[model samples]
Target: MNRIRVLVVDDSAVARMALSRILASSGRIEVVGAARDGAEAIKMARELRPDVITLDVEMPGMDGLKALETLAAGPWKVIMISSYTTRGAEITVKALEAGAADYLAKPSNISEIDRVSSALIEKIEAVAASTAPLRRKKRPIPPLPKACSALLIGASTGGPRAIITLFGRIKSPLPWPTAIAMHMLPGFTAPFAKHLAEKTGLPVIEVTERVIAEPGFIYVAPGGKDMLISSSGRNVHLRPDEPKATYNPSVDRLLETGAEVWGQGVIALILTGMGQDGLAGARAVRGRGGTVLVQDEESSVVWGMPRAVVSEGLAHGIMSPEEMADFLEKIRSMA
Candidate 1:
């Protein structure tokens, strides 16, 4: 296999050097070039034609967001390098919605870069392997029971963009409560929820405590904790508990608990993400006679999570974000 080509872009020379070193350390990756700022990055991207670009969120001139607008229209994929700050989280979320394939939070201590090396390398590989988003295809809406009670979504690497796209296409309020378990850091979930509310014109709240789940509202699981449905199926609880798995805000915990509560009344949608975090939960949902829909490979930034469901014959349907929205709209219409 050919080494994945990468372009590292950061205004700070130290950052650029550290990033280049990290990428170079990954034998599977090749650091083709480095850019000082967004402007230079754009020019270099055109000339270097790398497979992926690690873009810094903030730069002296023409920041990552602006450069992303240009690069997103091109052939290469982008992975945002963000500071671990509230402001950085906000901008990174925006970038994800705009078109970034994924993002990595920059650590304050340069020595700590080693700690994140594996994660960074993994993200780069995933982004480079992902296919470009394709045009939505019309499909027969998957059948659902008349008494669907909740909508649960799980995602990771490429989830933010997929989630935002799905909600943006919905023209009316959904008839069921929506719970999202997107893999994110502690400080990032709040901004992500705020952005979702602003863009989707829906009441989006990050669940930091127990709350009553209600239709027409979106509940986002807070980072570093798991959000589970209470046995009543009417309450959402935030805690770090049971059926432990690799990722906080575990999708498995959410869907497993949801299956326990709602049974066949649950509709689980697995979107673009890396790894098989949602596969086991999807199985539980399917076993309970609930619906499981996955984002089709052609429309996913990374098809890992969804592919796991499809491979296991756990998905009731495979559709793009647009199609998922249309299906939800149909359910709303029936309701």
Candidate 2:
């Protein structure tokens, strides 16, 4: 059987060794090469042609972002290793924007290294399996659906950078807050929210058990749970998810709740991911007069989520990230 080939890139010799050891520990993965800096990584990448690359955020001569820009345009899937700090998280987001598939936060200390080792292995394996090329390239302005009061986005796998890139294309703050349910594990959503706020220049918060939804902020569903929005006395409220649900932070559940409370006021964007989590929710949204749009397959790293909606004829529009932005701007123009 063919093994997953990996190239580990980092400035530190110890980190390179540690990461290589971890990858090698997994029998399914083969560490094909290691590079001390970004430049060397580029050279070695072209030579070794590994299936996946583990890139370190902080390098001496050349950094992960620079290398990512060059590699993202190429065929290889890259996962960034980032420090577990605010600054590190910000840099990691930049790497994703430049085309990273996923990220593993660097443990803060030696005692935490073992924890990160397991996570690193898991992410490496999962990311390596994704063979689809990223599709959303142009900065087409997204069209805003008419009379829409709130936006809901669902994604997994290649979702973070896609979300950041989509929001970055929007020139100004949105008229309404957006609720997002991106698949994630625990302990990552807080930093993810902070990074999204910094990237989009809009306020973002992780969803709690219950809170009133308001305009001018982005409400992100916390990892390992679901988000349900309702209306109470003219105020939109957030509530806990159903017990023993299938998908954590279930996209279908969130959209269904929005349809229940907001009816035609909700607009849904199903981005790249595996599975049909958002399709039924789109149905719910549309059944109640809401609008639903999905990312085009060519622009999506994996078109599963958006494809499901498209297959069912549930999406009002299917567009690329750039097109979505342009479409939204035009909708605002007509309004």
User: Judged by lDDT, which candidate is best?
Assistant: 1
Candidate 1 per-residue lDDT, tens place, 1-335, comes to 89999999988888888888989988999999999989999999999999999999988889999999999888999999999889999999999999899999989876677788899999999989887667767667678667779999999988999999999998856878999999998899999999999998998999988999998889999888999999988899988743455799899889999999999999999999999989999999999999999998887999999999999999999998988888888777787
The per-residue C-alpha lDDT of model 2 at residue 196 equals: 80
What residue runs in model 2 are displaced by over 4 Å at the alpha carbon? 11-18, 21-28, 59-61, 106-146, 185-211, 233-248, 311-313
Superposition TM-score, candidate 2 onto the true structure: 0.78
Candidate 2 per-residue C-alpha lDDT over 2-58 given as tens digits, one digit per residue, 9 for 90 to 100: 899999998888888888888898888999999999999999999999989999888
lDDT of each candidate versus the true structure: 0.91, 0.79
Model 1 Cα displacement at 316 (Å)? Answer: 0.8
Error of 1 at 164 (Å): 0.8
